[model samples]
Target: LTPELKCDRPDLRGNLVIKEKAITYQAGKEAVTQLQFERAVSCFSKAITLQPDQLQTQFYVERAEVYLQLCDFNSAALDYKHACYLEPQTKTHFHRLAFIYYLQGQCLCDQGMFLDALESFAKATELKPNFKPYHMRLACLTALGRYSDCIRLVTNWLKIDPPSADLFTLRARLYHQINQAALCYYDLKAALRLNPSCADALSLLEEMKEAAECSRQQAVSKAVEGELTNALSKITTAVEKNPEKAQYYLFGIIYRRLKDFIAAIEDLVLAVELCDAVAECSEREKPDNSNSLEEDAQAQLVLTYNDFAVHCFSQGFYSEAIKLLTKAIHEQRDESGLFINRGCFLKQEEWLFALADYQQAEELDPQNRSIWFRLALIHNTMGLHSFGKNFQDAADKFSLAIKYKPGVAQYYGNRAKAHTRMHRMEEAKLDALSALILGSTNDELLRLFPGCSLSDVISSATAQTVKAQLMEQTQMWKLAGRPVTEAVRKVLHQRQSLYRTGPRLSPLRLADASEAALCAAKHPYAWRNFRGLGLNC
Candidate 1:
């Protein structure tokens, strides 16, 4: 009977069923030999159905192979799993299952199902912890961006197996992805030492070195151009690639240039930490070589703190800036610039603290006129805020300022105001006259006096008269129900000016009368009504 007919009749005859299934299995084998995978699959399915309990594990495996050839990975995996179940103790069966799982994972990877593929390959490795399957699992993990998992897997595998160049290379690549460049370099070196002919390891090592150099050069170029953000990115890459203390220092420099004081401070702190660690390690290994890195790191730390303080000041973070400056001053006690900066920040809301800082700065550099001037200004401001309550202190500060820089007229004028507030008329006059001789204005002098000159009084009176006249005219226009147009306002303004300068005549001058006549002439009826009312013409 034909293979199809035999498969269709599984119970044709109990005595002949076994022989019939054997014939069907032979037909499936022949189909497979001819590479007709679909026909082979159909025949195999029928053979298994004919005598399900009698089927050998080889039967399932052969059919699974056919399924795989057809690229039906899911079906192939199932068939291979069934083979493994059928012959649980057979090593070949488990190996075949693992191979099928590996193939399934590759298919999943091609379809961009990285997570699923990772599971599949992981299962394959679990089923057969062989070289190829383990490596495949690592590759799948890498594709999934699970570098940590890959590293852990490789590390565990290395503990179990003898170290090989290929495994070392794989672990090195995993380290590279996570920015553990030192570990990556160690692995690459181990890989090359094991197999001196490993082209990939050598190439990777060279590439890392070249990448670090290129990054350093590009960062320097960007920094020279003041492209701070771009420089930061390049330096960051360099740090990730090499992570030397010097690279960290450069990263901090870039951050400082960007005015990211907080980030800069953090990076510099990290650099110092790393440097200390290195120094400790070196001392343990060779004590004579320890001081260089520590010394350089200490210097850089002080500079970093100073730069961080400046940025904090610019951003108006006075408390933080003062803290950073204090840290710098602690490290470099004689830095007048640091003391000055801290004093400037303190002057905003902490005058006493600011005064102390300026005093320290003055002791350090007594000839700095700018420092004296700042002290004078701060004292004057403080006196103003405490006017009549702290006049002596204000006068003392102004005198100190003039003592340092005797030619400044502003110091004398400010001192004169302070004395006037204290009722020291003689001292106030002397100071005011000195300020006037040194180019202070009369207005500045008048501020100290209780009364102005007669001419000044007369000018003030004239202004008041003009202001009253304008108001009266505006009120009169509103009472008369007139719109008070621009021409009428101009005439009113001229009338006020005339009253101010000319002799008093009926409380309105001849110029005002002529202006009124002009306005009345514009409306003859209004003028006639005015005369009828017995008003002055």
Candidate 2:
């Protein structure tokens, strides 16, 4: 052999380099077989660098495998991408690179890097043109409020034969965002035609059938046209089909119109639950409009509850009405009218519950005269069952009612009862007089002491009768020729105090409508039954 070694032979040098590349590739395979991942990555990478561009695809793919074994995903993804570029005709490399991009997009999305994630997802769609990448891209775009771009993407994809139902449904969802109810309806119909069992398409159809809350519009129209049966039938079918918020709401309202309160209540409850869920989901998918949607849902729920409650009350289902109004109050805690209506319902059940509700309403609107009146009634009932502090509370509540409208005879009459309960005779007499002047009868005032006996009570005798009795006794004492005793003077002062409660409303000054005012004067100590309709006044 010559010492020059024939280095100028270009073909031999090329042959040697090819042999070295082959040996390096073989060594990489051996290292991978032995599970020496670090050494395999180094060997495969060297082979990829030394191989010709046309032949480097296999080496890059092998290096990517080793990098995967080493848990170096970024390196593996780069190697797979290079393999795709080297061999554009091979689908396996393109699919692998596309999958890597999808995974990268998912990671970025989870990290809240929506824009970066979208770029990776778009690249995956460009390479694969499949469903998963499109779904990810669509979601990312929706979160970014790029609904127009999503519409374009879904619209282009929907051009395929036997068109994808899921694609149409997604486009409809985008249209819903842009308030294009007409387009949403068409797309939903197209989706249903493609695949009748598409759940999303069916629900959306229920939402946009008439382009303005479908079932509700149709149901209301049918009802107004004197087709109550047809309205109920339509709403029932819609509920069975979708059971969505609007469907349930319309169904409940139709049942309410038919006076089927039980069914109305059940459906309204379901609608409220669905509305609550939608409001929560809006917090994530539509944060910009979430608060308004939640508020609107709350208002709708409250109104529905109140409507059902009013129907329940008319049907004499007091308990059901009270429960519905209670739920309404829970949905709208600040709505004073809800509390007022609930208090009225609870009046037939228990005065304590009615009292609490009326108290809440008074707190919301201090100047609400009706609330004050209701509270007065509840407290009067409480006072009848209680004494002391409760009686005082009843009087105070009456005073509040009178403060708002001082002319109401019912308030003064109730205050008289409360005062009598607390043994404030002076105040009770004054209130009794005011009540009589304001149109309450003496019989109503007498009912204030329902089973109470006042035989020895000082107010039972008139000042004229006491004075005559004193005159007779004085004549008798003069005949006996004895000075007046201290006890007799004390009795005279007590009689003066009783007469100072002022003259009662005389029958002469009373209006002709108050003819019952004279009954108390003829029988000054008679008690009447308190169970009459006029007792509240």
Candidate 3:
């Protein structure tokens, strides 16, 4: 109007103000976008100071993102809280706050602050319901062994997202921990269909599908380990509550580990009878109660009976072991180890009965070395010293046992006994020495072969030389499969005379038979088999 000159000045002040504001806003946005989080933080702070109310929530949210990027989660959480405060009803604001809390919880988890992480994740789920974080927290709770808490969390998560593969997978894992294999498999199948690439879910499904087959076998192994820990705790409680229930089968497992085979059998037999009574009761009266607990109880009883019988046979309780084993066989006649064990025990006490049992067990499991060893021992013990046949047979079985259990010195020692019985003295000595080297210190065996005195051996070196000559002639006879010749006899005579002087078998005459040449003049054939057979030749 009146200030045309002022207008002509191009509104310099206003333009300058607009240009400064644009520059500030652009710098703040650029810093945040480029992930220069520290600079972005500063820039945003400056922008907020310059224009307090303009894009306030956006600025706060951007700065919070930058803080989170820098791993300053607590700081980012405060910024997000402020953003949410600025926009109370905005879903994005609540979601942003929840995400920040979730990230903070993850950091706490990585630091092993599990309780803190659980609280953070709980808070996140409260602010914004989600499928992933709830499952994640469920995993953390499971890891902490907080089974009840995990069940509650996963149950809530499942309600919200009934078809969520992750929640199903998590719930399946919890159910598996609680020994709910059937329920676990149901959930696992659901997860597998939803996410086939989930390795954990797939692996669990495979284990669950094989559960029936492995359950009895695994129950025995678990019962062995658990008898010392939680299994014992449960058994103790059960016994305290109901002493007449014959839960003493669990005690039998403990006694079996302690090697009290007699006690184990007694408790296990009673446990089996009690289990049978329980089964009868369940069938007749408690028809509606068809739970897995009752099934496992029955399975445990059967496994305990089998274990007891196996142990009895192993520890040489022949008659009693046979009774229990026969009972087990009548119940389930297909178990190879049961037949083998009973056969072995019977063979030890009554060979005729044992022979039929062993033959049956052999038909069932021909490749089992213990059964073979027992059979071979029986043959050898019953006057069947056919070295060509029995030795070879026993050798094969012992070799197999050695391959399976190389560290058990007794196996090697047993093979040595077989070799000794066959008149393979050097081979037997080598095996015995090997057994001793492997920690089999048998004083009885050590006393059987008197060690040579150094002086006596040296004093008889002349006689030894004559013996060496005779041995050499014998070896020549054996190798050529004939008797000693005239030339060899003459050489033996000279070697005998020379051996009386000093260790006169000179370096050249020492030949390939170093031990024979150095020791004395025994019949070279005396050591022929020892050397040719690769012993201390």
Candidate 4:
């Protein structure tokens, strides 16, 4: 039929009957209510074809939802856009347009096309003027270090919703971007007033306040910028003037940075004790806790505790770090990095209990290669070579570690050990050679295998030279281009036959070789050990 004629046709019958098909489209809607998306799409498509212009937008929209269920995002977007053009007055159409753009943006973001995702998210926010996607784009811009654009967009969003806690928090983040510590603290205080339970707002407020105080103190006390003794003298003088203040922890941090571990621990302990007494006295004064103010104090204490733990770990104080990290982990179990840090400290102490912690870390985040390598190393150290086999299980991980960290000669050396144990001699030799070549000192290879000297194993020659050396070694025992001893000859013959043909044994009969060797000591006629065989133990 001609295109024009088909458009004008009104004589179709049976399933194509307009009234019945309209009923079928209505039944499709009922089917959707019954959760039959496939049948709904089928009926909707047939209805649209039958009653040309009757419910094109509605039918396409329904079908588009079905396509979305089938994970056909591109087709769903196409159908949705068509529906929008068909019925521009539908608010749902514009919402779906924005939703599709959001989906596309997320897909692009997952693919690491952040700029493309930013454009798509901008389109979505233009369509809906919503906070969710706009904030997402703002965060993405911030992460990409596009601070100017992030500042402008976030400022505009804050103006549109001046009192919103999220906007205030975001504005505080913007102030942080420009290093305006006091301004960031003020915005964060505003955010906490709006939503006292927001952990991020409380954290930002505490951090900005600390930064501002640090700046003020640094500017006043040129005496603070000195050795630990000088700083401690200054703090002592300041405390003599005002002993009840909370600035002792700041002095503790200075001592900690100066490597005065004993003094730092003493001062930090005193600061925590003072802070506790203040908190207790305040609680006695105000029996009813103010939520926002209490949250602010709690945030400060958490930061102080976390920093103390990290400082202890850095100073090889694993037990102290573990004590603090355990408390933190009890409060926040979802933080996988804490487990990783604890595992590292445990490893430094050679505590096998760290294995369980590392396993937990890997469960939470499987992509951390350091955790994987540590696990593998722990297994190898414990003589659990089978469990350590993952390092050699896939060529990709072995290759990736080699590529990024060619300097860790011990890693290559250990991989060589693994490959050698697996009977991959050529790969083992290649790894050993790479280690010897890249390692700053040849002592690393010698340190690796205290059992065997790597220099003796790896000749001062290239790979081709080593191959030639092996060939020379092989030739030393050759008798008429083959092994000299009868047993060794038979073994080699069997190996060659198995390689050249199929699995067949007994290419040569060894009926008299043993007795011949026994008689050779007395008769002077039977075969003896080959010259290079070194038969005497």
Give per-residue CA lDDT, model 1, range 1-537, as digits (tens). 899988867566765878888888999999988998899999888887877654666778888889989988788888877887887787887887777788888888888888888888877888887656445766667877889998998899899999999999989988988989878888998999999999989988888878877887898898899887888888777776665535446367666666676777677777667666765574457445345544545555666777776666666677887898789888666655566777755436687788787778778766554566566666655655565678888788777666544555677788888888888987886676556555566586766545765245324644356446434644553444334556556556555444476643324244577878986654322111101111100
Model 4 Cα RMSD, 1 decimal: 37.3
* lDDT of candidate 4 over 273-339, digit per residue (tens): 6556666775556334333333333333333445566667667677887786676566445445556
Model number with the top lDDT = 1
Error of 4 at 62 (Å): 1.5
List lDDT for all candidates, in order.
0.71, 0.68, 0.61, 0.61
Off by over 4 Å in 1: 1-96, 99-123, 126-168, 174-207, 217-234, 258-263, 284-331, 390-394, 410-433, 442-537
Where does the lowest 10-residue lDDT sum fall in candidate 3?
A: 528-537
lDDT of 4 at 5: 79
Backbone clash pairs in model 1 (N, Cα, C under 3 Å; residues 3+ apart or in different chains), count: 0
Off by over 4 Å in 2: 1-220, 224-226, 236-251, 265-297, 345-349, 387-405, 410-429, 443-537
TM-score, cand. 4:
0.34
Candidate 3 per-residue C-alpha lDDT over 237-353 given as tens digits, one digit per residue, 9 for 90 to 100: 334323344543546565556556566556666665665666677456643533433433434434445566655645656566678667656654545555665664544456557
Write down the TM-score of every candidate. Answer: 0.54, 0.39, 0.34, 0.34
